[model samples]
Every structure is written in C-alpha cells, then in structure tokens.
Target: MRVNADFTKRVAVHFDRNDWIASPAAGVERKMLDRIGEEVARATTIVRFAPGSAFAAHTHDGGEEYLVLDGVFQDETGDFPAGSYVRNPPTSSHTPSAKEGATILVKLHQFDPEDRTEIRRSITGDSNLQLFKDSREDVRVLNLSPGEKLDLDAVDGLELFVIAGSVQESDEEFSVWDWLRLPPGARSTALAGAEGARIWIKSGHLSQMI
Candidate 1:
C-alpha cells in the first residue's frame, strides 16, 4: 500500500482529518504519512502504543528513527520519555514497548546502507534543538513565539511536522501533528499562530532516496 508516495510533489496532511489504523500488534495503531511497500515498507508514520503493549523483537535491517511524542517508549537500550529522539541504525535489534502508553513519529528503512551512527537525545524546554546533521540530511526542532516568522530554504527536499501549536504557510495553517513535504528546490516561509508553534524538520534526505 502507498500513501503520499510521490517524491516530486508537495503534500500536506492535517492530523485531525486522518484516521488511525491498527497494526498487526494488538493495541498498536498507526497514522501512515508516506509509504512505499507493504508490511516491511520504507515508511513514515506516527505510531501509538497502548499501556502495557509491546512489539515483538525485531532487527532494523534498514534503520529506524523516531521521536517520542508523549509518554514513555521502552526497549532493551533504555526508556525514552516524551521529547526524546532516537536512531537505531541498520542491524540494530530491539523489542519496543510502552508501559503507560506512548506515541511516536517514526521513519523506517531510510538510512544509507553504510551508515552506522546512533543518536539519542531529549528536547527540554523552549530552546531549539539540533537533532542530527550530516551530508545527507539536517534534522532539528524549532520553537516559535507567537507571531514569529520562519523562512524555509529547502534546496534539496523538505519534510516538516508540527509537534505542537500552529503555523501558517501562505493561506494554510498547520496545527499540532500536521505534516508537510516539499520537493527539491522549494523555498517558502511560515508564520506562527497566536499560540506559537513547535516544528520538527528534516531536509536534504529525500534527494538521496529519489
């Protein structure tokens, strides 16, 4: 199955308008953002785990990257609370679970085959956090004050997810959990809404995939 699989077009998804679909694991559901295959697909998704639920042990042959949206995410490595960002490179193995329920925005099977970097971080407070950066992509979190303006120069490609609050791009408003993807060479700007906004952005990655 595919959802927003085009790499050359700009697309947006509003959280409130999407429905959650259950995964093979009980009590685990997902909101698929982009996909390119079936069960073992290269995909971007928001996954939610109900309390006491766990996923079977698995190996990340292609890699796994995620940011905890709420609650705590657990694995053999450690317990990650909200605001935590993690990357499990290719060949890593883990059994993920949530004791008190949790939600996460995750990307799968998108790493360079030779890449082996591992990162774990937590975004605390209002400061902007630079999650990761390399030749292929730049990933970060930005916190905006009410009425602030943000300029985006996505020369390679762009993907932005609203983590909290709202921001407007042209006439369109992106609120919490809203997602946007832009093709290579796109340049744009967004203005924060009355309550400001917190956004997670990744750029320069899509070009490598396409």
Candidate 2:
C-alpha cells in the first residue's frame, strides 16, 4: 500500500494529474501524496468531505495534523473555516465532518510519540506562519509575491505543497494543490508565477522517520 514510499528519492505530484480515490467513509475521498502501510498508515493526503458527510469517531494513536483549504470543518471542539490549522497529537479523539463540504491537506502518524501538545489556529492573510517546530521538524506556510524565488534546503528532507497560484522548480511547474518532496541532502529553489503562490512546507522530519 505504498505510494512514493522511497525516502531517498525526490517525488512530485501535480494536482491536475492525480485522481481522487473514494475513502471507506461515504462521500469522502482522498488524493494520496505519499503512503506507507494499510488503512492506518504514515501518510500525507488531501481529503475532501461532501456536504452532510461525516467520518466515524476515531482516536489518533500516532497523531494527526490538518489545514483546512476550503469550506468549514467541524467537530465537537468547534468549527474551523478555511485557512485553519490543527494538530491533534497522539491519543486525541474526534468526529470530523463538513456541513457545507470542505477540503484539507493532512498528515497522519507522523508525530513524535512524546508530542502531546495541541495547536489550533487560523492562518488567513498571513505572509508567513510557523505552524510548528521541534527537533524533528519545522513546519511553515508562506505566501509569495509575484515572481519571487524561494530557496529551499533539504538537508534532512523537505516537502512542500502549493496551496495557491504556481511555482516553478528546475524545469517543472507546480500549480495549485501540487506537492513535492525532496530527499535528504537535496537543495532546490522555487520561483513564483505571475499570480504569486502560497505554500506549506515541512522539513527535517524524514531523517527522523527513515
């Protein structure tokens, strides 16, 4: 059940080229970026919930993190609109759904076993936002101006998702919702397009996992 499972290679997934696969839950679907395991696995994905759809209550034994891309995501704790970021560390439980449909980028089973801190916030209108940082990884969201260049170092592996606009790396261009992963020790640069770009980045984590 592995997709882009090689930790030593670079991988890129463009939004327009990937197909949505239906999830076990009704009216829910996912675009798997990387996966390693069965149902409950170490994975990165884009999930979409149809209106009135919900997933069964579940506990995250290995942790869960997500950023709402559109619409509203709701649970017993509260309702989260687009641009919201949430981290439910190990042992957290919740029933998640979207009353009006929603899209989110999520990472699962990727947290340190000792991490139990919870974070929930909105990142709207931010030029740059640091979501989290630990010895294992650094997570951030950045908004770029037109034709801007972003230098990235992958000393311990780096991953980025294009949330809006387009970015070019080497000879390849990434549009909205695209994802890219670089192996440890790699270095790359991304140049924004005419409309600029908004991206989420996570680095220094793969070495710990691999």
Candidate 3:
C-alpha cells in the first residue's frame, strides 16, 4: 500500500499515462499517484466526477488539499470552480459532489501537524502576482514565458507540476498532469514550451520526513 514512501529518493510521474480506476463512489474515477494506505489512505490523485456525481460524507484524518482543474467542485462548505485552490485542514469532514462534472488534483494526509494554514487561491487572468528576491532565494508564481527559470533556495527542494501547456527539464518533456519532485539541494531548470506555461510550483518542504 506504499508508493514512493521513501523520503530520500525522488519520485516523478505523468498522471496522464496512468489508467483511470473507478472509486467506490458512482460515476467517480481516479488516477492514483502516490498512496500509502488502504481506503482512507494518505494519497495524491486526480479525481474526475461525472455530472450529478456525489461522494458520501467522509472525514479526512490528516487533511486535504485540492485544486479544481476544470468545471466545478462542491461540498457542504462551498463551491470551488476551476482555478480554485483549497485546503481543508486536519480533522475536517465533508460530502463532495458535482452538478456539471469536474476534475481536481487532490492531496490527502500530507500536512504538517503544526502547519494548520488553510489557503484558497483563484488564479484567473488579471491577478497581480508579487515577487521577492533575496540573496539566497527567489520565489514567484505568475505568467511565465518560455526560457524563464526559477532558482529555488539550496536549503529546500523544488516541486513542479505543469498545470497548463508543456515544460522541458533536461531532456524530459512534461505536459499537463506531469509532476516532478526534486530532492533537497537538487539543481534543476525548466523551460516552458511553445504555448508558454502556467504552473503551481512549491518549495521549502525537502526536509520534511515522510
């Protein structure tokens, strides 16, 4: 029940290449990425809900983070449309359903017990992105053109996923749904392809023990 459970090694996968498997819920399918348990597992997956689909009420023991990739994702708490980022902290409960269908990237049980920050970001056009540069670190998330590179700090690691368009790192070409995890101190660079790129990039978690 473990996939990429080791913290020392890097794990990368192209979710688009994986087979879609049905979940227990009707009309809901998933592309499981990394999992570490049974039904209520610590997992990361891409879930697609057919129109009128619903999932029974459930509780997340650790936490849940999700980004709406397309359509609308809804729960008792609120409705999250495409481009929405959400985090339900540990010990949360909800019943999720979709009226017009939807797809989402979901991560479960990957939270730091003390890190209770919840975030919701809607990254549509006209959003003003703030950038900061220091001697040792530079962090930014905005419209990135081809050949633009981000240099993550040496103390932490970089995790990059191509949310839209394509990106090339070394000789590896990653399209939508492709994820790359770089180990601590790993030096890597990426370039957006012809269509340019919009990505969700996160760093500063390399020291976390899995």
What lDDT tens digits, residue by residue, belong to model 2 across residues 70-178?
A: 9999999999999899999999999999999999999999999999989999888847999899998999999999999999899999999988889999789999899
Off by over 4 Å in 3: 126-141, 152-154
Among all windows of 10 consecutive residues in model 3, the one with the lowest summed lDDT is 130-139
Q: Which candidate gets the maximum TM-score versus the true structure? A: 2
Residue-pair clashes per prediction, in order, are: 0, 0, 0
Clashing pairs in 1: none
| Candidates, ranked, TM-score | 2, 1, 3
Q: Tens-digit lDDT track for model 3 on 1-210?
A: 777666556667897678898998999999877788877888878899999999999887788878799999999878899988887878788999999999998878866655455666776663434322333223335555776665534356656767787888867888888877776777767777888777767666545643
Candidate 1 per-residue lDDT, tens place, 7-101, comes to 88888988889899999999999999999999889999999999999999999889999999999999999999998999999999999999999
Q: Indicate the TM-score of model 2.
A: 0.97
RMSD of each: 1.0, 0.9, 3.7
- Give the lDDT of residue 122 in candidate 1: 88
Better of 1 and 3 by lDDT: 1
Tell me how many residue pairs clash in candidate 2. Answer: 0
Write down the TM-score for model 3.
0.86
Model 1 Cα shift for residue 108 (angstroms): 0.5
